[model samples]
Target: MDDPVSAQRASSVRRSLASIVLGFELIVVFLATLVIFGLSDLPAWVTLGGGALLCLIMVGTLGLLRYNWAYGVGWAVQVVMVATGFLNPAMFFVGALFAGMWTYCMITGSRIDRQNK
Candidate 1:
């Protein structure tokens, strides 16, 4: 019989890796909202609304991790993070950094999956 443990590890490497990075990225965005884009700098509604939207995306990504299409949603979230630079310039650098990390995880994770299989 095939080794189930090895098989499961390979499957997880391919999928869950991106989700892990995304979860971290969401937290970073939340912190940046409060620190980099301070409450006094922006309107209360934008700050609260943006924070709420990020929370929703994070939860949705967590709940949808089992599906392949959820990765598409993950990419969309990445773009949103990068776009937030429009409000807080510092996010441009932070977002780009995470985007690179996310890309690396997806590519390397997929390669590991193929190799293990």
Candidate 2:
């Protein structure tokens, strides 16, 4: 039989790790928006508007992390982040760094959960 307390602890650990990654990613995405705004010749509305929309989505995703499907959304966000490289090459490196962190957190968190179980 599963121990309710252990299950809850595992869930909490996973959620906490995921939350941390998303929270930091929120800030990074916001800063990347500013970089795009200042550096790119693209229309201001496109950069600012797109950045705002992505930031909003990231925030929403953070809240949705409790659901398994949300992790897929998170992965999509990472891909978008990396794709930003087309706009600013620097973002490719930055995005990859965050993606690595995200991957690490997901894998490590799951390992911890399994151990707890």
Candidate 3:
């Protein structure tokens, strides 16, 4: 009595739409990472090093930005930089300054999102 073929076509269309949505999300993530990287005064080597560490953290922190542990990991990174004062105290302080601001923004954004929900 009903057309199953048209239903299958509709399902396919939904799948395509979902794929497009996910692709857009990936693009947004890359742009956000770029902005985050751009906002810091980190040196080339420090940026490269931080980039690598961020990649690792992203693997674990994906879809968990609202979690306290995400902020904890960020703070830990800042603390590690602070503790490396022997290497270059200025570098550490500069990085921690940026890191602290970034963490503050992230926390505030999460709070806003929670409140808006």
Model 3 segments beyond 4 Å from truth? 1-68
Using TM-score, rank the candidates from best to worst.
Answer: 2, 1, 3
Clashing pairs in 2: none
- State candidate 1's TM-score: 0.82
Error of 3 at 111 (Å): 2.8
RMSD of each: 3.3, 3.2, 11.9
Highest-scoring model, lDDT: 2
Q: In candidate 3, what are the lDDT values of residues 1-117, reduced to their tens digit?
A: 668765543334323332333334334334434554566566656755654555555445433433446546555544554554444445456555555655555556556545644
Clashes of each: 0, 0, 0
Model 1 clashes, total count: 0
Pull out the clashing pairs in model 1.
Answer: none
Decide which is better by lDDT, 2 or 3.
Answer: 2
Report the C-alpha lDDT of model 2 over 87-111, residue by residue, as the tens digit. 9999899889989988998898888
- Which number leads on TM-score? 2
